[model samples]
Target: MKTLTLAATAILLTAGFASAQTVRIGTEGAYPPYNMINDAGEVDGYERELGDELCKRAELDCTWVKNDWDSIIPNLVSGNYDAIMAGMAINEERQKVIQFTQNYVPPQASAYAAMSADADVEGGVVAAQTGTIQASHVAETGATLVEFATPDETLAAVRNGEADAVFADKEYLVPHVEESNGELVWIGEDIALDEGIGVGLRQSDTELKDKFDAAIASMKEDGSLNEMIGKWFGEGAPLFE
Candidate 1:
């Protein structure tokens, strides 16, 4: 009798564990359109909106956490966050350490400089976002790379003539350039570095990954994803037509 009761209790405990779901989403709140803080002191932007929708669709309790860009991956691996929603691109290197959900949006990259020739990068000094693909790309070119933690700092480096130009994603850079009072320019073409972006999870959490995949698919089907994109980039937003 005792053995049977113990087996039943174990089964119930396992069931309860299976049903438990709480996901922590991480983002670098410094990047606008993806994640950023407005004057209201609240985090607002594309990734935040999309993450809320994902949690609702998946029926999971969710919390948002702001993480520095360079530390996001490490925190996720340490189980500090269940997923990363910071417009993170899934690449071969990242896949080794984490699993990614389905792609959420079209891929886009951009390169730009100030309009004035004086702002032109000489001697190939370019500013790139630290820990991003753009930084890797510029480094490969053997350019004297000046790394910045935020988009604003990267643009500021170029605007102030501290660096030649900056390369990054179009989604965040376009609006910044226009709003910078002619301090920046959109270069001829965006550099294609990789495919679309997705949510990052620890390698052991395959069940959570499956949930995220289904939620993202539903979001795409119901046009919620499109709505969020338009909200951030506008109807005529480059890259999402």
Candidate 2:
């Protein structure tokens, strides 16, 4: 009986070791609706659901890892994680550093929010999450750009009068505006940029990228992706299809 127990233990250990090699899905857990740390302190939200489905379809064992938004791309390149599904937009500049799966979410409108309806969106001081496309856009425009390490900080900056306006994804800003009662208001036209959101992978991880791409394509064809989008972002949300 002792010998039989030892053999079973060895097998179990081997299986556990293999399972530890799960593909790591990196994300910024701070971004709500897209991705966030739930009450249980695990990664949850739209990207969480979407990414899990893609991994299942691809037949890949996966796990989630949280990282700061500013270092997301760099950490992916450094092999800290196998892929990035943290609501990242696919753009030319990012493509130069790493490959991207086909966009799972379509191009989204970037918008500005301010404390007052008459705030100078184009010429006033604007706050944006550091290292994001919105920050880049603000830097190029006539507005003065103040960058924060996290999304919450950018919104806080506008609320505290450090910035006249805050620029970010329209969808992300919506909840804040709604919760603010009359304190916050959407201002300025939507700024459209990039192709869409996709999973970021290292340049050499074409196999992994292809798997995710195929999974995303499958979700689009079957309408499950669209359903998930609506479930998280409302029925009027933009979808890949």
Model 2 Cα lDDT, one tens digit per residue, 186-236: 896888987889999999987676567666776776688899989999977
Q: Which candidate has the highest lDDT of all?
A: 2
For residues 138-161, what per-residue lDDT tens digits would candidate 1 score against the true structure?
778766888998777987887777
Candidate 1, which ten residues in sequence have the lowest lDDT sum?
A: 1-10
List the RMSD of every prediction in angstroms.
8.4, 9.7
lDDT of candidates 1 onward, in order = 0.75, 0.86
Instruction: Please give the lDDT score at residue 169 for candidate 2.
Output: 90
Report clash pairs, candidate 2.
Answer: none
What TM-score does candidate 2 reach? 0.90
> Which candidate has the highest TM-score of all?
2
Model 1 Cα displacement at 57 (Å)?
0.6
lDDT of 1 at 51: 84
